[model samples]
Target: MAGISGLKVIVKKNKMKIVVLISILVLSVSCRNKEIKSVEKIDTSKETEEIISENKSKPDTSYTTDIPHIEDFQNEVMKEEDILFNGRLKKYFTLSEFETVFGQNDSIKLLLEEEPCYTIFENKDGSVDPEDKYLYKEGSRFENSKDKVAVDEFKFTKSNFVLFKGIRLDSSTSISDLQKIFPNATKNIGSMDVYKEGKVQVIQLREDENNVSDGHINIFIKNGKLYSMHWWYPC
Candidate 1:
């Protein structure tokens, strides 16, 4: 062995080596912890994105899905509505009763029995025609296309209507307007049969067998509102 001073120097060198090893170990542990944190953040971000995507893909839960198809759902709704809304006890009537429901004289003009009847539909913007606006085309029979009747009336021989409007609710309308038109009609029976004119309201009668119904009326609905009414006329 060497002198005591030599021994002290060797001890000092051994301690320095141990300190370096400890520092290297601490740095490795810190790097491992940082990598773990990065992985956790990535997983959380991916999970959040998946949740958002799932929410967007889901459809409405409130609508009925028990039916096999969309049409089945509609049929079920109509059947349910008929049961709930129909309250008429008068099933069938004689020709006199038919005349009683419909007026004795001509009230509604049957202008377009061959083609579609014309009626002016209020524009959707709910804007009434401007007072100064005149619908016309230069040297044309129709002043303007917009000036023409906006509504078309059709006579239905069947109980069901499958008509649809792409950009508009063609069958949708307010019941208030019908009420105002037909003050005599206090309630709806089997079909949509309400009409309004000054003080006299005409009833539109619809029948499954063409103007002969003692029970059931069919109402037309569109755009979440009542469009038209019809019940059978006893013939």
Candidate 2:
């Protein structure tokens, strides 16, 4: 009977060993599956960060603020016709209008010898021909002359002239004042100034002891006062 009990006990011990071995194999498989899932999650997170970084490095081509359109520029240029002069939209005077303003003075005459054509007006009673001659187009308006449609050129030789835009000027009109009015004037010499508008020299101020005179429009000054102004057009 004792021998039979020993055999039964051995069988029970073998069954317990088999169960422990199965449990160990199942636990190892479960731990390996969890580790693989963790690794996959880390790789996905890295891929997402790389995509975000690449998108940030690219330039945005759709932004276009503060860029002026071509139509805006055209509109600005079209508005030039509304420029005011002499409290009116007329930027220049016609021959008849000039005559009306200064009257039919005997001092004015046409200069056929002058290049680009001109009309000279002087002080009738001044001695030495006044050392100045106001020049304008003979038959056309001031705007026509300026636009190169009438006379070729014009200028003022005398300084004491109240011109269009109410530009009351003389030799006494300082260089600083002229710069304020014509911010584009270039310094030619001592107190001699030259202003160019649209490739043509429109105004010049000359003050030199050397008597150097060469410009479309010339302004000669003495004693810091405007002595003369000359206007002409380039051929």
Candidate 3:
């Protein structure tokens, strides 16, 4: 009986050892599969991160999508027929020439007695109908020379005179008519004391619309008609 029991114990011990070896083998295989899956997950996460970073580095050009395009203006050079008043007088008209044509001024005053004096012409007399005035700058061309008296600006007040193309100031005349008369004229930004700068439309007349730096004329409009005008030479 003892011999038989000892044999049984040996067999039981061998069976227990086999069970432990099988469990260890199963656990090793499970750990290897888990490691491989973890490696694959890490590779996939890196690829996704690289794709996101590449997308973030690109520029977004959506700002200019909705802006409207503007067309360029076609400017036309002025012609001789565009001259104001009688279309005979030219800019910088000399004092001697003016006196010869229009006779002596009603009154003359030296507004500025300095080296480059400013002379003003007034026609208060009832002989010549229009209340015309001219401003001359002495020594405008040469220093302290009376021979170089230049007509810097002129004003025609209380007059219903017709301009180029028979354009005149009257109740029927609109701003559009003035613009048609001076198509190349631009909006004037200079001083206008008689009318509100915003309420009135003032345009600067140029010999060549392309050359803005040269001498020009400023025409003021009020109540849809011509209010005042002045020729500027920037002396």
Candidate 4:
């Protein structure tokens, strides 16, 4: 009877050992699965960071908010009809041509001593006087070089001289009127002393981003009325 009890005890011990071994195997598998999950999580985070870095390295190509180029502004806002002066825009004219437009050569005053030498075609009419309304060939010694030149600029102090599409220096013209006429025109606010009050606006065309050329117009409005205008173009 005692021998049979010992055999039963040994069998019970063996069964407990088998259960412990199986538990250990299951725990090992669970730990390995947890390690693999941790590695996968790290890889996913790394991939996400890489994607974000790549996106940051790429250049932004959106120009929707950028100011339009000068040429584009002219084409879109101030069309050819709006800028025609005496049926022509900023064209170089020979002395004969200028004479034909203004009158005989003797009537036109050629200012040789002035810097950036220009010519004057004073209106005998009292409305727009004194300020000879045209720039001679810019950067040329007018006394020496008889080269062909044109009216590179026009200074308008009176309301009678129409600048663009019947727009002139008059009480009827206002900042709002200019804004309507040139929707894309840029303001020279807080830059030049003349524009400190945010009243002067600059209209430029044919000037590139690098400022390779000089072609622009300045309109000054005071007390909500168009005060004066200056139109300029490269020779």
Better of 2 and 4 by lDDT: 4
| Candidate 1 runs further than 4 Å off | 60-235
The 10-residue segment with the lowest total lDDT in model 2:
72-81
* Model 4 pairs in collision: 118-136
Q: What C-alpha lDDT do the candidate models reach, one value each?
A: 0.37, 0.43, 0.50, 0.49
Can you give the TM-score per candidate against the true fold?
Answer: 0.30, 0.35, 0.39, 0.37
| Candidate 2, position 96, lDDT | 64
Report how far off residue 90 is in candidate 4 (Å).
4.5
Candidate 3 residues lying further than 4 Å off, grouped into runs, are: 1-85, 111-150, 157-173, 183-191, 195-200, 212-215, 233-235
Candidate 2, residues 1-235: lDDT per residue as tens digits? 9999999999999999999999999999999999999999999999999999998898877796898765332211101133222233232455565454434433433232332232333224422132233234322123222212122233323412434345555435665666555443334424444343222222343222232433234444444444444344332
Off by over 4 Å in 4: 1-82, 86-173, 180-186, 189-217, 220-228, 231-235
Q: Model 2, residue 181: displacement in angstroms?
A: 10
Strongest candidate by TM-score: 3
Ranking by TM-score: 3, 4, 2, 1
Q: What is the C-alpha RMSD of each candidate to the true structure, in Å?
A: 18.7, 12.2, 11.6, 10.5
What are the clash counts of all predictions, listed in order? 15, 10, 0, 1
Residue-level lDDT of model 4, residues 1-235, one tens digit each, is: 9999999999999999999999999999999999999999999999999999999999877746777565654422333345544344334556566545544332234342243322323234422233332333321111212545444433333322345665543446676776666555534222234523453544443333444445554555556565444444543
Better of 1 and 3 by TM-score: 3
